[model samples]
Target: MSTNTLAPVLTPERLATAYSYSSYRQLIDELQAQGKTTGLQQSAALTHYTHLNVQRMQRLDKTTQVVPELREAVQNLQQSYMWLVLTEGWCGDAAQIVPVLEAIAQASNGRFTTRYFLRDENLDLMDRYLTNGSRSIPKLVVLRVDTLQEVAQWGPRPAEAQALFLSLKSSGATHEEYAEKVHAWYARNKTQATQQELLTLVRDLA
Candidate 1:
């Protein structure tokens, strides 16, 4: 990757507060034990979702693989990068996506490091990364490690899943209906699209 010409988006102080993947996972478990979720405006529904997300993350942790294309992409990176992810425990997309990201980073042979930031606790950063003007969780902001300058980003959901979401919404599908379909899509996808898209981003960074 070439030297980033843009200003750094994250201050060192902020980056220092981000948690490792293991810490992030432990946090969710700890919070769940206390009947809590990772964000403000908590309720039984949010807590329930958090419970579901934990299971999803656990399954993904055990199953999501770093496809050869993505592994090769990371193996070829000429510069190091940091992936700062904004997420919340109740976020289904984050639950399904974060583990895949961790898997990829771990397989990357030290080419990349990933950190987790609970979205609500980092509103100042989250505000800068809105998707279609909405606060979307699981936003991955890639930075050139040396300068902390952002190279690119990927998140919220894969394009196909996003399209399904929008279609269901515009067609007046119920919230439950859309949610079921979107998550079912994630179940079938099994992280392939996520890895492929990230692979494209990694190549672009190169």
Candidate 2:
């Protein structure tokens, strides 16, 4: 799997220019207004997934519960950073994870801000953060707000969830089967795993 070598050259100014999540939502709204759907491309599956993710994000936004540990970790953050995320509206993992990330940022009390980029539209940026040579959606690139230097990164999914997904894939489970199981894991985990992992990352940087 290839990893990004050029990431170090990226600066805060460049990152700051990336589209915000609100902008991405505006784009989605425009598409819907045009009687078209989907974030980056036009396809029935993409449209369906896009709408599904919209609803998922809304529901999670209202319902995600942050544990005490995560709240404290974010509260104690001594420096500012940006969670520049590459995702698409059709990405299931993004639907599950992005809201939780937004919650974390919100709890950070302005120490952390998140920006969203459509993975397909930002191929160069996404390529720099690819997972195992694959352009994985919902890739969170954590960068220092002062210097834009990478502090840490997370995503695709939490480790435990990724493990379950890999297990199902290796067993030759169909896409539907694996997807159902992976989402069920998210439903059960309820952002705890993601929060804990992100807390560890933030603590290390602190």
For each candidate in turn, the TM-score is 0.96, 0.89
Per-model lDDT: 0.89, 0.79
Model 2: per-residue Cα lDDT over 78-187, one tens digit each: 88888888887778899899888888888888988988877887788888777778887788888767666676788888999989988999999998799889988988
Pairs of colliding residues, candidate 1: none
RMSD of each: 1.8, 2.9
**Model 2 clash tally?**
0
Model number with the top lDDT: 1
Off by over 4 Å in 2: 1-13, 33-40
